[model samples]
Target: MTAADQPPQGGRGPRRAVAAAERTRQPTEVRRRLIVDAAVPLIAERGYASVGVRDVAAAAGVSVGTVTYHFGSVQEVLSEAMVLHIERYYTALSEAAEHATTAAEALRLLVDALFTEDTDRHWRMWFEYWHAGEQGTDEAFARGQADRYAAWHRQIRALAERGVGDGEFSCDDLDGFTTRFAALADGLALQRLRQAPPLTTQEARHHLNRFIERELTPRSPL
Candidate 1:
C-alpha cells in the first residue's frame, strides 16, 4: 500500500517500537492529575492570576515545561480546579437532596450542611470563586456562579412544588419564591461564616425553618 499507511520498512519496526516507547514514556493521566491537584491549593490560596505555570510546576515538583505540557495555560488549570470544586459541592448538594423528605426539611438540611462546623473549608473555596467571578476574567468562573445559583434554585423549586402538593405551603410563583428563599439561605450562610461565634447548625436550621414556616403556613388551609 502507500508508504504512510504501510508498516515500517526498516524490517526491525524500529519506528513503531520508538513510537510505542514514547507513548509509554509519557505520563498522561498522572501529569493531568498532578496539575489539577497542585492547582487547587495554590489557586485557593493565591488565586488564578497570581499563580503561573512555573509556580504550579514548582508546587507540583515537576518542571515548568511539564506544567505547560499538561495544561496549555494557567487559565486552563484554574478552570479544571474550579470544576473540581463544583463537583465537590454538587456531591454534597446531591447527598442533601436525597436526605431531605419535605421541602422545609430540605432547605434546613441544605443550610445546615453549608454552615456546619466541617464545611468551613468548602465555604472558603466558594468565597475564592465568588471573588474570581466578580473580576470576570474567566468565563468558567462566571458560569460557575450561575451554575450554583441555578442548581440551588432547582432544588428549592422542587421543594416548593412538593410543599404545595402536600398542602404545607401556598405559592403561585414558584420561581420567584424559590429565588428569594435561596437568597435568604445564602445570606444567612455568609453571615454564619463571616460572623464571630457563627450560628450553630441547629440555630441556622431553626432560623431557616421559622422563615419557611412563616411564609408557607397556609392561612385558610389552602
Candidate 2:
C-alpha cells in the first residue's frame, strides 16, 4: 500500500491525529506553489546547480517526499521556478509597454523597467540560466532561454509594426531594427549587472532612449 493509504501504526492516539492532520493539509496546488515560491529565490541566489529537492523542501517547510511527489525531480522543480520567473518578468514588461502614446515612449518605459531594482533578482536568474546554457549542463534551460528570447523579439517587433502603422515612427527595415534594438538592450543590461564601467540605471535608460530616437524617424504631420 502507498504511504497515503497506510494506517496509523502501534494504535497510538498521537500518531493517528498526525496522520489525519496530514490528510487535511493544504491542497496539492497550494503546496506546489509553495515549493515553487521557495525554489525561485534559492535558485536565483545559489544557482540551479547548487540547490536540490531537500533545500526546496526545507525552504517550503515540507518534506522531501512532498517536493518529489509534486515535481517528480529536482530539474522539474527548477524548470518550473524559472518558468514562473520569466512569466512574471514578461507580464511586467507588457504592462509597462502597453498604452504608451508612441512606440518610442513604450521602448523607453521598457528600458527603464528593465534596469530597476525590482528586476534585479530576475536578471540574476537570467544570467544563471545563460551560464547553464553555456556550460551545456542543462538542455531544458537552454531551450527555455531560446523560447523566451523569441517571445521578446516578437513583442518588440509588434511594437515596431504598430509604430509604423500609426505613423508615429518610420523604420525601413523592421526586422533589422528589432534585432539591433534587442541586442543593444541586452548588452546594456549585462554591462550594468557586471558593473563594467559602472553605468547607472538612468544612464542606461538614457542611452537606449537616444538610440531609439536616432533609429526611428518621427513621421511628418499631414
Candidate 3:
C-alpha cells in the first residue's frame, strides 16, 4: 500500500477519524432547524434587527461558524424565522377553525385565538416586521409581509364563501367583505399593540361579533 493509504501507527488515520465524526454528527437539516428555532424566539423577544449571529449561536449551543454554515447571512436567518412563526400561527388558526361548526363560529374562534397572551409575542414580532418594511430596511421582510397578508386574505375569503354557501351571510361580494374584515382585524390588532387605552380582548371580540352579525343572518338553534 502507498504511504498515504497506510493507517497511522498509534491510532486511526485522519480519513477514518473524519468518517467517524461525520457518522456521529447531526444531519444538516436537523442542525439548520436547531439554529432556526433558537434564533426565532430571540428575534421575537428582541426585534430581528437587534439579533446577531453570535446571539443565535449562543442560544443554539453551536459555534458561530455552524450558524454561518447553515444560513448564509443574518437576513436569511431572519427570513426563515419569519416563515416558521407564520407557520405556527397558521397551524393554530387552522386547529381552531377545525373545531368550529360554522364559518361565523370559526371566525370568532380565530379572533379569540389571535388576542391571547400566548400570541402577544407573535404580534410583537409581526409589528417589527411591519416597521422594518415601512423603513425600507429589509426588502425580503417587506415582501414576506405582503405575502402573509395575501394569505390572510385568501383564508378569510374562503371562510366568507363558506358562510354564503351555508346561507348564513347576505354579502354578494365575498372579495370586498374579506378585504374589509381583514382591514378591521388588523386595525384592532394594531390598537391593542399600541396599548394607548388598549382595546380589551372582550371589547375586540364584541366588535368583531357585532360586525359579523350585521353581515350574516342569525342561525336558529336546532
TM-score of each: 0.70, 0.82, 0.80
Pick by lDDT: 1 or 2, better one: 2
* TM-score computed on alpha carbons, candidate 3: 0.80
The collision pairs in model 2 are: none
Clashes of each: 0, 0, 0
lDDT of 2 by residue, 1-222 (tens): 997676657666566468547745879888888889899999988888999889998898777877888887887887788788888888889887997887777877788887776666777787776665676556767787799888989988988888889899999988988899888877887888888889878888888888878788888999
lDDT of each: 0.71, 0.81, 0.77
Model 1 TM-score, 2 decimals: 0.70
Ranking by lDDT: 2, 3, 1
Off by over 4 Å in 2: 1-25, 135-143
Report the C-alpha displacement of residue 89, candidate 1, in angstroms. 1.3
Error of 3 at 79 (Å): 1.5
Give the alpha carbon lDDT tens digit for every residue of 153-195 in model 1. Answer: 7877887788788776787788877777777776776777777
Please identify model 1 stretches exceeding 4 Å from their true place. Answer: 1-30, 45-55, 196-202, 218-222
Supply the global lDDT for candidate 2: 0.81
| Candidate 1 steric clashes | 0
